[model samples]
Target: MTSGIPDSIMALVVKQDGYNPNPEGGIHFETMEPYLEFKEIAVPDLAAGQVLVGMAMAPINPSDLHFLKGEYGQPRRAGKPAGFEGVGTVIAAGEDPYAQSLIGTRVSFAATPDGTGTWATHAVAEAMLCIPQPDSVGDHDAAGFIVNPLTAAAMFEEAKAAGSPGIVLTAGASQVSKFIVALARDSGLDSICIVRRDVHNQVLTDLGATVILNQTEDDFAAELTSTMKERKPRFFIDAVADATSTQVFNAMGKDSTWMIYGSLSPETPPLPNTGELIFRNKVIKGFWLSPWLSGAALDEKLAVFAEVQARFSDGRWSTEVGATVKLDSAVETLVEALADPRGKVFIQP
Candidate 1:
């Protein structure tokens, strides 16, 4: 797979003829007919500033599922590759200066052009678009680290700036939540993690989270309220949004900054109380990775990446990827796990 596809290579392609953004069913609907096909096709030649990459590994992120179902973000054209994040090695480089610098290097890239993505074993990308993998990070960890770590890092800064006493993180057992909790601990702040099950408590508690509240437990709000009374966490990062969450958060003290990043809830996000804002100054906002990271320079982005990597190297930060799979199983693995309520799946492409 390191070598270029001489005649043909397999890829996941859109199967439908016409693109449909708002299909009858929502993004999670699995049509009996795959709009995309997994088949072998001839690989294209590299252009200037482009490099042929042998994809090493990629993670099955929530965004990947959304892209596949046509429910996340703006609707992309059908037949386009679905994955946006991955780590790959430069197998061939074009003549551009940046491309020349990337020869033989492995990197993690941002949004690649349509039809060129990490779902396949190979991709051709602009050399500058890739973030070189530091020598310290292994390929598996590096693959899962970039997108989630960066997002968590950004949210940490946001929470700090908002002047919250501590941060409340929902879906605290997920990979991204691990980074958020680790970052909060490093910053000398406490994190209150909200879990769906009691079993998830040990994971966050071992990671230094002070409070772990299982949403399924009875009178969870009373427990949360009691904890809030001790040391109020004015900042909340909800990777899971639902009506119950809205009610629980509404019960928080005023002047809190709540940022909703993911919608694990089947229902629409619950509306925030205007009274909290009108009288107490509570703020609720939404966050999407593409929009947030879109305009950042590679160097600037790498700085944050470097910091997070150092934390990992020092054994201060770590993510629990519950499962690992080979690159060939990318689609099937993702379809199953994205539907599951727990665990981070890593694809070693």
Candidate 2:
């Protein structure tokens, strides 16, 4: 156990009370008295190459919602604390090659195996799992930047690898979409950003998106088809998976790659047509950033931050648009944010 941090720490606990008639059943939230009252076990002792970090901030990402609802991925065996990515300050370190220099540093990173998530106040993790944050970056920005920025980078890399001229992003104006827009702009790559409403157009356009289309408008398909009439979009990344959006993908020329990464439509399940793949030579792929990033090289992961930080500092990428909430109000903030598409809910500790 560590010297000062104490055995128990204030944490969000989830338990499987019972099943419900509704789909989102079997999960519940409760704030215990305090850290010390729980099991009274020792604080997690640092192992060789391990470090103790006090989580500073973490976002309620879509996957986090799934984790909370016990829907996506394998359902947790039973009760478990949940979170995916976070920025934390190191308080102690174990014997390791990297420990000497990493102590007392704030880092932004992601971890797995459920218990090591970023949802709590303090976490003990391997030193390699922590990516040191620059002194220039604020804690809030550092926390919010980790996952979305990396996803945006990966998407761009995927598109470029396919020799695609431009990229198409569903769920435009989302925290991730905005990052994609900024990243694409900086790389001088053309992109079409799709939003569900006309109201979202100007916001994304002002953020440097050249082409913005409304998914609900009658002319939506025509607009997309006419714009890309000469050349079909080789890459389509959908964060919004609706039957209508899939229709758009179906209309694209053969030999195109459509990646489905999200399901913004609550009622519609993604149903891909087989003929497109068989006859049109099209491909439909799914992506989940967490599993893909597991076991990636440290240098490769750190590179994401270096690029994202550079863009953020230069005004090419932004983190200011999201709604910010203090740590104490975190649960309420998350509930409200999850109910609406207002913006990402950022919790500061």
Candidate 3:
């Protein structure tokens, strides 16, 4: 037990009513404020093999907003705090040696399914789930450590396993997609990147992307078809699920798989063309990080963590934080963060 740690601390609580039935077409300041509240709460008791983390920083990810809207894969209860991953200092721990050893060290942690989340000043997490951060990794980078990097690595690994000559990725300008581009370059695999604007082309090309197509261009379909002919990409990673998803799916090679990981668009993607599916042997699937990480072997999980940490240490993989907000100003800051498309936003609790 840590004698100096406070018994009570401030936290951002998400009530059941937090889900906005209509998010004004999408999540905005007005829609999100009614759902999130800041209040003082009792620190959670540490269970065996658990540690109490004094949260330093947490990012406002797209999934966090989806979770607030109650659209996530797992169910979130009322009166629970909101946040998926963050970096913090372990001030207290339970009886386990591994848990106790984490005390005084800063680590990155993902929120427990049924417990307090990282949006609070204090959060309790399983010691094994808390990966100790090296001195070289900053709080901002560490806060985003678990989600994007690991998912990118896993996606690339899966593509490699399929023995595909190259992979097609939508939302090429997103942070995870950027990581995928870098990972593919390092692995000597080609990546066909699809973005919504022409401005994103040079940046993605600089990131080692093999081909960059602007989805907004008048000749987008033509460019995509020609690129498909040259690349013959066997795997398509879809994040923006809309009409573009159907177009990309139809363009993929025969027997190719389209993995849908995120839905940035408000409208659901139209059904795949039956002719293509029946004759081309195309498949559509979903990929969620939780199950993918949970099903991974312990050694494999540790290896991924080690790889991510090393990448952060060497500046190979990183996240750009646009702004940081205190717990009290989260609502307004989140709106501002959402408006900015360039970088992520962090919460310093």
TM-score of each: 0.88, 0.85, 0.95
Off by over 4 Å in 1: 1-6, 16-36, 297-299, 326-334, 337-342
Better model by lDDT: candidate 1 vs candidate 2: 1
What tens digits encode model 1's per-residue C-alpha lDDT throughout 15-66?
5443354543233644413645566756877677777778887776766655
Candidate 3: list runs displaced more than 4 Å.
Answer: 17-29
Q: Ranking under lDDT, best-scoring first? A: 3, 1, 2
lDDT agreement of model 2 with the native:
0.67
Q: How good is model 2 by TM-score? A: 0.85
In Å, residue 274's CA in model 2 sits off its true spot by 3.7
lDDT of 3 by residue, 1-349 (tens): 5454677978788876434455422233445666678878877777878888889999888788778776777665666788899999999888899988989999998987645788889888889889999889988889999988888888888888988888889988888898899888888889998888766677778889999988889999999999998889989887778899799888888888898888777776688888878999988888889997889999998998898899889988778767778888776566776777667888887
Q: How many residue pairs clash in each candidate?
A: 4, 0, 0
Better of 1 and 3 by lDDT: 3
Query: Model 2, 115: alpha-carbon shift in Å?
Result: 5.3
lDDT string for model 2 (66-97, tens) is 45555565454333344567788887777786
What is the C-alpha local distance difference test score of each model? 0.71, 0.67, 0.83
Clashes of 3: 0
